[model samples]
Target: MSKKNRKFLATTVTAAAVAAVLAPSVSADELKFTDVSDTYADAVNFLVGNGITKGVEDTKFGTHQNITRVDAAVLVARALGFDENGKYKDAGFTDVPDRAKWAVNALVQNNVVDGLSTTKFGSYDNLTRGQTAKLLANAAKLPVNDGVTKTKFTDVNENFAKYVDALVREGVTKGKEETKFGANDAVKRGELALFLDRAKEHFGFFDLFVMHTNDTHAKADMGPKRATAVKELRSEHKNNLLVDAGDVFSGTLYFNEFQGAADLQMMNYMGYDAMTFGNHEFDLGSSEEGHKALASFVKNAKFPMLSANLDFSKDELFIGLQNNRYTSDYSNGIYDGIVVDVNGEEVGIFGLTTEETPTISSTGEVQFANYVEKAKEAVAAFEARGVDKIIALTHLGYNDSLNFDNDLELAKKVEGIDIIVGGHTHSELKDPVVSNEFDAPTIIVQAGTQSKYLGTLNAVFNEDGVVTSFGGELVKVGDFEADAKAEEILAPYKKKVDELMNQSTGVSTEVALDGGRDSNNEGNSSVRHNETNLGNLITDGMLATAKTINDKTTIAMQNGGGIRASIDEGDITVGEVMTVLPFGNALAIMELKGSEIKAALEHSVSADLRDDKTGLKESGAFLHVSGLKFEYDSSKPAGERVTKVEVSEGDKFVALDDAKTYFVATNTFTAAGGDGYDMFGKAYADGRVSEPGNVDYQMFIDYLNVLDKVAPAVEGRIVDVNPAAAKTVAE
Candidate 1:
């Protein structure tokens, strides 16, 4: 039978149920209702409320009687205000006899039912769940959010795709979370109510300040927690916005495997209002194909991409859907800036990225113009166009010291920008740092790299759209409830990464770890300290590895900042090591004059001496070095603290002279004099140094795997100097 006829027939059979509503004066127990008491009760109440159904008599709701197709159609038509107004011929249903002709005509005219065959209507079939949802959704004139692309849902296969898609998108139905939508199941009255409520919420509009995220690096779930804080603020003020700063792309292997497809999906499911690009968005290798892949990854996104800087005019990456582009720079095309409505106020947003694209982005060709200049122009245009409230979605670094050309400088230089939501040098701003250089306060914020932190800024704008008063907080990921939808999206990808990392490598006695110096922030000891066992293990491991490569190589030296994290006591794996040493830098073998080595030693020693955080002075050298021993005088000044230096030739201490050269193994960064090692870095520039592969972490791991149990201990590698007591005060 045709679908129309089946619907018509089902309508006829259910017409009695639809029309009968128990009278308020009568008790439900006395009301004559159907066998499905729960369904009937709800249906009766709803129908009666909506004026679709009425009781058979004062107290009789005749729900049990099988409803004919014609009766169902007439009742439904009456509810829809189609009584006699909607005209229809005597639609011939094979089973519907002439006696019920008016009902059939009414059903057919309302488009709620049709004959089973060209000349017959099956008017006695019961309505199923799938059919019920579709009918209700259509009756309400709801809009379906069927994505422009398809996903992998078993139940949403070809045959019922359209109806299922519409019902699900219109919020009339839901799959059994983590399971397929059972389309064939019988419809329940309770489920129907939920569908209706959801549909209403979907169509009902409310002013919203939406915050969103993308490419959080491996920040492993920080977005959810920060979003919660923002949500709380949103609830209180009823006007707020939160969003992600990007690059959730490549630094971590978790992002490498799924190409961040799962991450982006989670962001979309979390109801993010918008997103901008990060350099890592081009990590998969930016070509037409790579950009296309990224585009596809975000294709399910309901919100649009806002990249005012990228020019995709000639790039195949943006060929077809130019509408996806949104800013003032491009007018004939879709502009990148969006005016988000907040309680009758329009707030404009534009996105910008760092100019370091040429060096950092691995994917498709990226062209970045002067962000500060472009931003100033954009803001001026927004103001001229009468858009007072403005926000810049920036992927600029927060610590300009780390990223020489940072966006914070941009914020300082630009006058009209209200808020600079920044990323890149992932800084965890516990609170918003207000920039007063601009006429109005320019707030700068960033979630630390990896999904570990989320940055939120709250602003109260004046009539001119400049922020008069504002504050922000950085939220830790552990603080909030993980959005269920985000969890669902991440499950598979997380499972895959877990499977890969769970393979055991070695175990530690206990957690021997410390997250080293964070370049993104100002502090050093949090990640870079002499006390961290991680630093000890890494330097020792490098020394051990160098011994294998060069028997003459003594004392492996590793920068404190290079020691990523301590190996916590537990099942260790290759993945953890990779995470600790993601740079893949290589070891460099250098011959340095004794005096120069001593000077290099003085730099770190001094930095550690005056450093209030870690008491590294009592711990010899802050820089983990093997094959060398020295002591320091805690009472002496920094550069003069190292009093004595000794070199060991396998258990023997030897005298060292300033003119003599010692062969040492350390990272190229050090050899090039990074971290105040000007002497070493300058050595390489003078062609007195040699270096190896860019992947240094591999060498450390190889050294570790070979040892049955590597035990690294602190020796008196550095000696302290004290002036032989003054002839003195005693005399």
Candidate 2:
């Protein structure tokens, strides 16, 4: 057979396998077959008992006879749950006899078999070993051979090479010998029976299928679609696990209005097994109201909220929320790890949140330990309990610029973890990153943010609990139809959010206010790197709000990382504004010397300026200024990157006087020195900052209300002295 022909046949058999849905088991003792080898007698009896075959006679079995094409089809069809008595129309093969028509028609209708020609069934033609391997491999729906390129058997044609390898990988069949499959050799009755039996056992083996998502950020629209995909995948595979890598809060109007209720409801509907806390999960933890929101989200979550490194012992809000505490023994709840039985095998799972949560979000009284150290303890704990396969549910990000403990680093430093489902960087990895730096294979995967994609990883583990073969793919949630149940659950929350979303903010923009993180020269809208129109609009709001109290507040700055989304050109609604600035941060004003401002700028660009060969670095701390301008070079050293700084004075740009104190406006997150801005943190601690009691998004709304039409563009507020070098850094 040609490669094209083999692919066509494989597709046919795979479809048949999916439709068949074979039953649990069949008793081999019920079958009595004569003239069978002792090694193959049980296998032949298994096939006979399943109605896949019958002896040549009641007392005699044709174990030595060459299996025919029709014989092979009947066995495969029966193994795949085809009933001979079913109402199947006669296949259009003219040469097929009526006695064998049922089996041929069933296989043909399911695309498992094609006629030898357009009209001839070729029912009597002897089935070859290569052909038998192809049929059995396809019927089992075994993963396609990835590493096997050349044929293991010299006699096997390239067309049948992959099929043979797949069969070998599944332990269904080895070649007739070590290096010779005897491609054209006819399969005897006993040998065919053994192949079918092994194939059935291969299907019975427990393979783990994990469907995961992360960083949904309250995109409730993705809930129903993601539920649909998870449902379909769970139905298709056994021993399946569904998980979330956290960051389900703080992005759109849904989170702002419902306070993660809608997102949690959706997750509950999807039946998540486990979840970890992302930094955004702690975004609403400053007051009782914020703590209540988090408490409510945790109360409603049906699954365990895992975090091994967090010391929630000192926190009252999370008094009873700890799933499992770190100790020699493990229970369930918010613990270091938990072991769940997956098809009779205990799968140990643990969770890890980034250690930088306290500095980035309002993680009050929740001290965090080193992720790597905690991970080691979790692995050891699981292994002590005889659990060999361990999975790490983490929010450490894929690779972050802040030199934080990321997933890739975790995989390298840790020894026992088998898989790491991660989030926080919002990276869309089409392929799972396989790292073999430790004792076992560590597969790392993260679906992109906002519920746009659903990641599925199927892994086959050996008896020792080590992964031997793996396959993964990201299922696009947008491509799937929304589940009615998920949508119904979200209806009430949607109505409330819809009301707030439709409220017009009384501002229209001629161009989109871009807040994306991509490095494009068109608008430089990625607030993480350079000045953006949206950033300017936001800081202008802060400056205007601050000026109400102190007229001397000349400079306004906002962290690029704090700006979430962009607004397209047209009528802007309150919902769009909320989506762009969903953290619910309040406006703050602070007094800082010109020299202090320059030092802050230097700290802001330090991550990007420090070249560890990662190219252009992005820091959420990268300041977007309204009344100040500065230029930096990527080729310069980290602390000395900012060469020139100036502030706007009476419609004219003047050099910043290091000795002069100026009032500056920014969000409380920045004023408190979130994103590693230590200077701002120290200044705020010294009573140089004052709270204006204004919500950040409300400030933007008030600022926009004064303008009939708003169109802010990126100007020379932020200049890269070496533009070419900066582009390299961005790349």
Top candidate (TM-score): 2
Residue lDDT tens for model 1, 1-731: 00111111111113343233210122132244433265444335434433445555554555554344444544445444444544467665567655456656765655655555786565665445545544545445555444423324465445455656677665456676545676565444345434543443222212223343433664444444544555565676456665665675654446556666666665655556556777767656644356665666556555655666665555565565445332333322224566666666777778776666555345355456677777776677677677777788877655432233465577667777667777764445665555545334556666655565555554544334544334345556567786665565567777787776765556443444554453333443433433345666676777776665556677667776665555655667877787787654455667788898778767766654334422343222247666776665545667786677777776798765789877788876576666778887677655565432223565666667776675554343543333221111122
Model 1's TM-score against the true structure: 0.49
Colliding pairs, model 2: 322-334, 323-332, 323-333, 323-334, 324-333, 324-334, 324-335, 616-729
Q: Against the hidden reference, what TM-scores do the models get? A: 0.49, 0.55
Candidate 1's C-alpha runs over 4 A off are 1-215, 220-233, 286-293, 313-315, 321-335, 401-404, 504-572, 575-600, 606-621, 625-638, 642-731
Report the Cα lDDT for residue 548, model 2: 75
Candidate 1: worst-modelled 10 consecutive residues by lDDT: 1-10
Model 2 residue 245 distance off true place after TM-score fit, in angstroms: 0.7
